[model samples]
Target: MNKRPSILIVDDEVSNIEILSAVLEEDHDIYFATSGDEAIATARAALPDLILLDVLMPGTDGYEVCTSLKGDPLLADVPVIFTTALGDQEAEVKGLELGAIDYIAKPISPVVVRARVRNHLEMKRMRDDLAKLAVTDALTGLGNRRRLEQALNIETARLALTSGTLSVIILDIDFFKRFNDLYGHTAGDRCLTMVAAALNRAVHHASDLTIRYGGEEFACVLPETEHDRAMDIAHGIRERVEALNIPHSGSDVAATVSVSIGVATAACVPGATPEAWVKAADAELYKAKAAGRNSVSGRTFQVVVEDARPLSSTA
Candidate 1:
């Protein structure tokens, strides 16, 4: 069954809240707040599909609330409609400029409110679907490179503030090109899918993210993890891929499928950036590949100075 969308109604007047709630409650899970602060809190907590905002309020008026919501990363995507009694053209223009998707002037009509809410909700659903498609890999059903980079940036920033550790593991299928040449691209694609699934299964932590990092390589972002734990996870990934027993006749290393992994961890400092972390991991990956294909190599580094310069690995 399709779940009903949620809507947040923010108004300072009791009658306004009650009327809107009565209209929208039948179709949506309704949440209401009588003040701007309460509205912001409720919207953040509930993450409603849409917001019905009143422009005139005592404190943190509707315009201020809308601006706040648009500024927040978590709430930025939610659509907002101004439900104001101020029917002037200037008022509507200001609300739209402040990031409201639509403005509906009151004395409220239940039918108009219902239709506008439904239309906006449908539009939101489509936009969300398209956004997901943009960040997801169609072949392996893992996150694509764009998503990986975004996640890496977010994690790195988070760890910098907390002085926590973040690790990245880069895994490449051993002799993947040879496999594709010998077995045909169809089989090679199947191999990638299998390997992607194995890597996804090996990292069980909710905070860990696995992504398809371009052709023949995959990446795992592990936040708040240490070097030893990252190595263990890397080894587990190698073992899982091998256990799949996919025949690799072109390879000299093993009779079946195998992978090489490089792991890099950062004890994040103020200046640390996502690119440096990935570069460090890529360097380790080069070492692993050079050491002869099917193996795991890992190192740890710390950010130095305020510039976020990376120091040579202490590992």
Candidate 2:
């Protein structure tokens, strides 16, 4: 079952909060705050889909609360609705300027409140769906290049603070172009999908990301993983793809489809760059291709606090 959308109601008067909750509780999960400071704290904690805020409060009025919500990166996108007794146009304009999506006058009509909340929630859901689709691969149902970059940026930034380990694996289907020419594009697409599924199965952690990195190539971003563990996963992927037994008549490596993998691991530091990490992996990929198309090549980098240097080790 789908989870119900949540709402946070902020009003100084206990009666006002109870009224809004009575109206919204059946269709949505409801939370309440009695002051503007409490409203901001509750919004951050609950991450509500929509916030119904009262304009008049003892401290930190609704306008100030809305400003703080808009300023927070994690809470910025949450929709805010001002529920205030101030019926004047100037007051409404001020709330809108501070990023409230809608202004509802006091002696609120339940029907209008319901309609506005439903409309805004639907709009938020659509925006979220579009955002996900933008980073998804159409054919493979895996994350695309854009998603990979986003994950890398986030994980690496976390690493800077935590001094944790990060790993990346790049895999390429052996003789993919020849396979396409021999079996046709449709068969090639089927092959790609199958490989993507295998990769999804291989990654065990929720934080790990498997990406379709353009044609014939794929990538994995593993956070808080060590060199030996990353190499093991890479080898597992190579074995899994070969085990699929998707026939590749044009291949030199094996009768069945196979992959060459490159792995890179590093102890992350403040000055580290994701591009350098990927480049190291790509260099290993070149080596894997040169040695033979159905193998894994890997290296680990030890990062200094002040500088990053590659401490290459072949696997």
Candidate 3:
């Protein structure tokens, strides 16, 4: 069963908060904030799906609160509805300009409030679903290359500030073309899905992300992980893929489906970029292919060198 969507009712008046809560509590998980500051804090903590905001609260009014919420990257996408007595055109325009999805005038009608809330919540759910689909791979259900690059960039910046380490593993199916040609494209897609699932299972950490990096290739981003552990994870992925037992008679590497993995680990440093990290992993992948398929190659860098120099394998 789906969990109830959460809503935050922000109003200074206890009576108003209670009324909105009673209206929404049956269908939604409801939270109350008596002031704008409290509302902001609660929204950040709870990340409610929808907010019902009163316009005339003391200290920080609904307009200011909505602005703050819209400015926040984490909270910006959350839908906000202004529940206020000021039903004038100017007030509604200002609220909309500040990123509110709807404006509800007081004295509130329970039925209208309920219907609008349901409609807005449903719309938000659809929007969220679409956004997720945009970044997700359709065949493998893993994050797509764009999503992986975005995550890599964000992690690189974060670790740069903390002087931490980040690792990447790039892997591809051995003799995938021959497998596809022999088994047909349909079977090839199934094999790719199976490999993606194995890679996903092998990562095992919430902080790690597995992504489908285009056709027949996948990548894993391991944040705050060092060289040895990264290599272990890569090898584990290789073992898992081989154990899938998907037959690949066209390949010479193994009787069953197998993969080659390349691992690159680096400490965050000046001039480090996500592209360079990926290139390092790609180079290691080249080495893995050179050494023969169904193997893992890895390298660790102390700091990012901006000279575009070739990276040597540490293992």
Model 3: what TM-score?
A: 0.74
Q: Could you tell me how far off, in angstroms, the CA of residue 252 lies in candidate 3 after the best superposition?
A: 5.6
| Residue-pair clashes, model 1 | 1
Cα lDDT of candidate 2 equals 0.88
- Better model by TM-score, 2 or 3? 3
lDDT of 2 by residue, 1-315 (tens): 999999999999999999999999999999999999988878867889999999989879988999999976457889999998878899999999999999888898999999999999999999989978988999999998888776776677557667899999999999999999999999999999999999998999988999998899999999999989999999999989988999988999899999999999997777676676778888888899999889999999765444443222121
Clashing pairs in 1: 271-308
> All predictions: root-mean-square deviation over Cα?
5.2, 6.1, 6.0
Give one digit per residue, the lDDT tens place, for model 3 in 81-121: 99988769998998999899998889999999999999999
Residue pairs with backbone atoms closer than 3 Å in model 2 (clashes): none
Give the whole-model CA lDDT for all candidates, comma-separated. Answer: 0.89, 0.88, 0.88
- The TM-scores, one per candidate, come to 0.78, 0.72, 0.74
Worst window of 10 by summed lDDT in candidate 2:
306-315
Q: Per-residue lDDT of 1-315 in model 1, one digit per residue for the tens?
A: 998999999999989989999988988899999999999989867989999999999989999999999976558889999988777899899889989999888999999999999999999999989988988999999988887877776676556767989999998999999999999999999999999999999999988999998899999999999999999999999999999999999887999989999999988766676777788888899899999979999899875545543332221
lDDT of 2 at 145: 84
What is the lDDT for 221 in model 1? 92
